[model samples]
Target: MKVFTTTLGEIGNQLSLRLDSKYRETWDNEKGDPIKKTSLNKIKVADLINRLPIKRVKKGELEDECNLLSISETEAKYGRLVNSIQPVTSVGSDKTILNEAEIIVSKLVMSKGYIFTNEESSTDLIGSTELIPYKKRKKDIDLTFIRHLLLLDDYLKYYSGLETGKTPSQKRVNPIDFLQLLVPNVPYDIQKEIGTKIRKLENEMDELKKEIQNRNKIINEILATEFNIDFQEVLDIKKPTTYKKDLLSINNSFDLRFSYKFNAQKYKKLLSKIAQHKVSPLKDFINEPIRLGSSISPSDYDDDNGEAIYISMSSIKNWTLDKDGSRRVSEEYFEKNKVANSIKKGDIIIARSGEGTIGKVALIEDDIDAIFADFTMRVRISNSHNPKYFYYYFCSDLFQLIVEKEKKGLGNNTNFFPNQLKRFPIIQVSLNQQNEIVKKIEEKLEKVRQAEMALVSKKLEIDNLIRKAIV
Candidate 1:
């Protein structure tokens, strides 16, 4: 009997597992002609399958299909499923749901591709695209084999269209269209073997995530236990004495408390002393205050290699410094602008504007001549300022709570002017007390960081082994 395989373009082009679209070749960092590729596919969803047996199963049932039954239902479900990991509570009525074993189809739309699913498994109000059944098809290829084949670049390219100017529009993949594509004939036993290997790798990734979370918890506990700080104190900048209810400044610090282990005793103590600071809008007491990007002359800046370290928006994440990928500028640019006065290693860099991350802070550890970008604000504490203490304080749950409360706008982004950032409130502590807190935090954080690195290395090893086994 002749075997049948589905191509990605045959499916409707919205979002799904069958939608595999190959990305066009692009220039690499070395300017070499090396081709870059991804394993993702664009699936085209269609109005078909509304009558299919798209039953909503519990997470346990789905896990059983993937494990004991050795079945695959890898479709992205809109509403909550039995084993939904990243549960989306706010799914639209039209959204689709697929058994964890079903495959999502894809059709390349632009430089990147979108996912597709079917209505039978999805909510009618949410309007999900479509779901293609790999397990149901009685072909030489097993479900796992189908999943692996869909991950190939050849299928994506076959379904993807030509580049129009700089943008490319990929053809969508419909269910009927996908079932007609040519697929490799692989043995069922081989597919099962590969699936086992892939699952093992995925487990490693999960372990790494858990390890990182726990590590961060340790850091939080140390802060709570040693510093006597509550993770949720609201720093009241304007007293009732200063302004009426309408004008009073009340900011709930960041919700970092969620990331930390809660300590009721420490929280109570911190709350009791909230009004101790007599000053309005407390200062962190820095020796040198640095304004980002102001030190560089506009004429001297270059995108290429310069002597100076440039801290771009991408260089910072979770208020921690990403030293390897941060931007760099020319050293000569620093001298010409006379911008080096206040820039220092210990300065806390804060985001001035952007979505959701406005007022995020990072401590500079690089000693090189570095300049901040326009979107960043830099501050250095004076002799009175303790760098380590300030680092912990900025990263504290209470501080982040205050920041979100003061958040002005909406959407994925946010912004705060330099003056507004300066006026942003902080919890005031004595210099000696601040140093003590920072010391404890560093010791605990160091242990956490070490554990996280080990877990990451193990995950990388597991992924490499699985990929090698498949290839």
Candidate 2:
């Protein structure tokens, strides 16, 4: 749908015979004459830095104890240094040696870039081959400034378009192409000033994150008191010695479970405490049978102007549904699967699979034209119970602890079936009491939400400041 034209002379100057539409489109959109015409001077990245050669060292050759820097240990954007220490045998692959004067830029993703700041250490650091190291040749250039400049959207887009690989995940930027990118040639003083301002803003963001963590602890404390169970204590309890007789003693019927995690001593103690209160299985309050979503093949996905949203496990986060990054399916698929997968107000959805994502619960407050994926299950509460009260309970540690005990499988493919969820214990309370509890929790959650919004606004301010400075 997009079109552009370039002269043959321009192609010759580029030193590459790339005539692909995607590359040309990105070049026309981001590589305008502004970099050359602006009042501030512009310089190619090659003019300010020298590329360091990759020196691969086998695990046997490394010192018994040394610092190893991997790309996964470093964060995108604000992270500036790598500080991982481990035995030589722990290193997975060959590494490239780096000095304090060099900056390592991740070729896999544009946002990941770091500068070496620890000159106090006498030994040279080794890093993953995925990171391309460059040493500054110009004394006046600020490495921090250059790191942030590479993260700029304009440069990233142009560079990404030139990346080569068969698949999106495997694509990488070549060192030659990276060195050819342009950067703003601001004064050395201004560059340092921008870096300092960014560091200050980053520190403020860290404090706000700590505040959010404290607020979560407060919420958990309130839930602990209400449930009359020390969730952390239950988690910390070690696995007790068990025998085949112990499993038979609990349940002799054909439905009896055999997994050790299912009959852990900690879970048994927690259940005994709940028995003292008015409690019942979750199946008792369900208005209808629990619904498991059907699978949709990726071939059926229609990301461009699709009619219905495909709600996967990623769509549910922080006790709510997030539309961002969710896939889209054709209207035909929705109509065919709506009976079991359609989401309605007052219904609750839970992630039924995935390692870290399992047991995530969200309450649907409004009707949505979306269908849940196979990895998620939905529950509709009866009119006799307050749905919001159960929503809060599902979001609490008590329910999550049970999930940890019940979920089956290994690693990332864990599963919590509808039968296990139906047998979940729920504390039964009067309608009036349930409403009161919901109201109390909502009040506390509102304050947390406000703090979260402020953090988001602060992040935007920092991003805008960087954009303005570079422009």
Candidate 3:
């Protein structure tokens, strides 16, 4: 008699059935708004989560601010990606202790940032917050697979479901609850295969993204070279010999950054770029006067049937507004405050303050019954400036760098004052050149956008296949 062995394909088919059932359960288990009506998702996340004690280093032990993780950094990647960070709070009621279990969760979030670690090491995690250092082979689990799982839509929805709190700042997720979520259980060898496959797909996607970014860099490089702008020199760190004396003056004047030389030089360099061309104070180029957003509380309004849309600062991202994330105000409130908080077409919007969101600029392209919150600012950019061109530059790194330095405060309290926004500069070129630049940039951007859409479709297909593969 001949014996037969089960194939990976057979395992995957079974997994697909299991995932379909899981999706049905989740759809039926709807708690609040579904965002989209489409049915969702696969794989049991609980089986894959390696429940281990978290560790964190103290704020005092680390000299650099970037070493400490902030809550604002937690919004994306299951609170994993640590793009940048501020040092621990020097003076605040909420303090973080270093090298402990509370900090351990932070490590779990960013463990993948470290790619090359010795698997033989006894410590599953390293002391430094830069890497995820966990080692447990006796149980034979895969962290890479788990990391990607945390990034999945099914997992994110479940995680969001676990969160409690009426508003964003007040909201929090329980680590214990997160650990309890179910995950697909597969053979150890198969787990590694799924992880490796997903990593490769991500790498391919990343490479294509790099190409798109390089194309954008080409646009900025063209702008700089054509205008002979040397940003490095303009932003040089070399200060005067009497820096200490000037530093006192800067502090006394209430500038948190104390970058007197940089700001002064930046103006000189900007003027140099303009040459003899007429420059406009951001105020001059505004037809409708610039004003800060209203202090209306979002908690006051109902979600669906409000008279007007209440725009939250969170809805403004990378020069675009997410209407779904916005809140709706009651009819009475809208009627009373609509004139004061009106956002007309062609008006520019910016996130004025708060952690993770300062100086995020977007343009209102539609006329709608919407009212921006207190943490936002609005201005109708004049006909003199091209809204697209101005918005593109506002979203650029060069502009963000300025905003980053100018912003004040720590943690969730971080703020960009209204006075600073009022004083912002608006550089102008001929309307024809603005049109040409916009035309050139959009042409390349459209290609990148199409490629990105295809990439997303490909990713979803691969993710579904992976769910099926190991199940």
Instruction: Give the top-scoring candidate (lDDT).
Output: 2
lDDT of 1 by residue, 213-245 (tens): 443355557656654545334333221222122
Query: What TM-score, over all chains together, does every model reach?
Result: 0.59, 0.77, 0.61
Prediction 1 TM-score vs. true = 0.59
Best by TM-score: 2
In angstroms, the error of model 3 at 71 is 12
lDDT by residue (tens digit), candidate 2, 1-471: 765687777667664566767666655555532244346677777888888777666655556455666556554554446333333544667776665435666676542233343323425567677766677887776655666666655555566676666777667766676677677777888777877776676667667665564433555676667767775775464445554446456586335666777766667777776676888999998999888887999766788867678888888877688876688888778888887789888989899998889998888888878898889999999999999888888887668778988888887888988888999999898899889878877787677777788877866776666566666
Query: What are the lDDT scores of the predictions, listed in order?
Result: 0.46, 0.71, 0.56
**Candidate 1 or 2, higher TM-score?**
2
Better of 1 and 2 by lDDT: 2
Give candidates' CA RMSD values in order. Answer: 10.9, 4.9, 11.5
Q: What is the lDDT of candidate 3?
A: 0.56
List runs of model 1 lying over 4 Å from the truth: 1-90, 99-101, 105-187, 197-208, 214-222, 226-273, 276-284, 290-292, 295-301, 338-342, 383-385, 405-425, 428-436, 439-455
Off by over 4 Å in 3: 1-200, 212-222, 235-277, 297-300, 353-356, 397-424
| Each model's total of backbone clashes | 83, 0, 24
lDDT, residue 373, candidate 2? 83
RMSD of 1: 10.9
